[model samples]
Target: MHNDALCNFWTSTLGERPPARPRLTAHLQADVAIVGAGFTGLWTAYYLKRLSPALNIVVLEAERVGHGASGRNGGWVVGNLAGLERHIGGLSLDERRLCCGVVADNVDELGGVLAREGIDADFHKGGAIYAAARYRDQVAIQRGYLQHLHDLGHRETDCCWLDAGQLAEKARFRDGYGGIYHRQVATVNPARLVTGLAECAERLGVTIHEHSRAEILERRKVSTGEGSVEAPTIVCATEGYADGFHDFKRHVLPVQSLVVATEPLSESVWQEIGMAERPAFSDASRLINYGHRTADGRIVFGARGSYRLGARSKADQAIGEAAMRMRRDLLVDLLPALEGVRITHGWGGSLGLSRNFRPHAILDRRHGLATAGGYAGEGVAASHLFGRTLADMILERDTELARMPWAFADASHRQLIKRWEIEPLRWLAAQAITFSYAGEEALMRRGKPLPLIKPALQRMNDYFASVIE
Candidate 1:
């Protein structure tokens, strides 16, 4: 079941198989080289050239462009981490503001680049929805985060609230207590955006090598099985598929997240079932379920299909029929009457998640080789944010963008594990959570009071959608 599920989703809903990339075949030298051509790699190269056009830059890809999460994602580009509102107490107002500002600008930065480059990845800057699937979920969100929004003074025309009944009528909105509208957020055709960026980068004289995977990193050089690349600086942007390093296993968890796409809805159907509010929605559950309506009317959806609490997670891994069932059932709860809706595309990809919920770019600064991974599922906007900043850091010995947060400061280290141990444990823990969260969501639908731990955990699975998912 797991194998079948993985094959279908990765190969189908995710779109075309990437063209074969030529492996690195000879030694090369450049001022800067980027590993992984997803958003981070492309953005890093773009920004580097933007800063200094004379500098030589190269970007290498393991598969066809955007084959990673950037291509596989549901096209929701966001700036903030899920559950960040709940952690603001420890941060000062100014610190909090800085964090919020970075996120707020995340989309705007993408928009500016997209427009300037004239790349039409179907960019839509309208806004997105952060929905509450249950009454209890609504209560928690309103009582807590509404104040956070007000405190930040971050309200924009595109950001606000909507009640449950209002949620029911959203385009494809089946049911929910209420939803939060996040202005400044947008959705795009991820593959288009990725390809467009690759083109833009190339037009700017940035050379890109597709099907080129880097397998080794020395003090200031990277050696792919096919060739070696020596550069003044190198950045690793591989998300969940970043196992090509010694330090990756410990520093990041490659989570397998599943996504499915419905056939494009008829125009009449879209008008009748969709919401005027256009943001994506995620529920409060230990296991979160999220989805968004594309510009073309197909619903792209995903959630915590991967869990590696004490084990390893891999992108090629399958999500299994049981996980799919849980997701389908949960989707039914969110949109009760849509049982017959056919899911035309199903697949999952892995994201490299750091223990912390932030994207990072790690550098062996003195040595000139840097590695960045671990978006923790918040990749879309965060990837650009990190990529740009990392570019600045490498281009100029230091960046004005304050030093990386402590959580992302660790030198990359490989995980300590025997093959037989961690993977099974991770699978077991995920299964247990899946069972418990499903039962809890069902109980909530019946108006039964949530158990003590349930409400606190409503957004648990939201760990999906993060950069690594």
Candidate 2:
């Protein structure tokens, strides 16, 4: 599909786009100036205004609200962070559990906020199933992952093993070996969530300017083409779409991810597929894949994405025909009941990946700067927690959220977050990892016991994951 011909399934659900908010045309001063109107920025604005209704806040967006990865994600409101271990690995057991509890509770807290704000967004807390569906090797891979999660202080009640029969009761996968049933996960229609959040922030007295791209970000000022905002604090919330705005792109590289949604299936077909609980699911593959049963009876699926050579952010929603077909084939391979199902939508967007593979919410009080991002494709829920944390930090509230390990107070991110490797080296490393993972997956699919090559490739991939995941 061509860029112009494609449409995002989530946006399509919104029926029509609302009129664009006016671009910044007059110099403005506020208590806080924020860049980017996606989940992080709007969530930060929302919480800021809610916590202190008298405070003045202004939000600047390069495009429309939810136009970035916020509207383009796979819709899984995961309760855990993607690079979580890196943050909690060094903490004491009790402290690690505290952080994990905070993270796991974030899903319900987000849903509660949505309910209180009356934003439908199809919020459903059916949890998630990380299945070992394709091959026998996946069984061991999943078991190891479960152990790792437990070691990271995730509660056993929140994350436990489900045997083949229990897994089948939840989701009837092709092999259905076994899986981890994570109880703290849920899914949401991301487009609705982001748009509704922008509205909620506005209702909370936030001034939002669409199409006002932040050209320069100074200590306590942000400049657009025709206007600028000066405030006591400045926030840069542009994650994967950071582009050349300030030095954020250097710290958080943008990687492109694509997703596709199938046409609504018949009730009988759904019966054969057996996602009756509508839980999110993914197989144990290095080529990452995830999907869920939509409230509207469709299946939305996405897989591993690629890193552009120059770390360029994707602007368009459309993806090529080959990329769409590849995902469709993979989906069918995982769920044979959808052999002839038609795919209704295919789109792509960029997501931020930090050099250290850890998400952070930083407040440089000395420099009057605050930022939160590098979600690593799990921004849907993390954005909320980090946004609230940023608000608490900016408010100087001595709350537990402000004390979380991932929340850095009074420190410059440049000093804390490492910069990504320069272009060619970064691109070359990404390609090498992709090829290695593909080779490993191919060997696994063949189901032959190539003892030496398989074990060696697995070990090498594990090392790569440790470095970048």
Candidate number with greatest TM-score = 2
Regions of model 1 farther than 4 Å from truth: 1-21, 82-91, 134-138, 148-159, 164-172, 308-329, 397-436, 450-469
| lDDT tens per residue, model 2, 1-469 | 5532256888888876778999999999899999999999999999999999999999999989988999878999998998988888999999889999999999999999999999989999999999999898899999999999999999999999999999999989888999999999999999999999999899889999999888999989999999999999999998998776658888999988899999999999989989888999999998899999999999999986899988889888898778889999999988999999898899988999899889999999988999999899999999999999999999999999999889999899899889988879999999999999999999999989999999999999999998987
State every prediction's TM-score relative to the real structure.
0.82, 0.99
| Cα deviation of 177, candidate 1, in Å | 2.6
Least lDDT summed over 10 consecutive residues: which range in candidate 1?
A: 412-421
How many residue pairs collide in each prediction? 31, 0
Top lDDT model? 2
In candidate 2, residue 5 scores what lDDT? 27
Error of 2 at 236 (Å): 0.4
Instruction: Assess the local accuracy of residue 294 in candidate 1 as a C-alpha lDDT between 0 and 100.
Output: 75
Deviation from truth (RMSD, Å), model 1 = 4.9
Q: What value of lDDT does candidate 2 attain over all alpha carbons?
A: 0.92
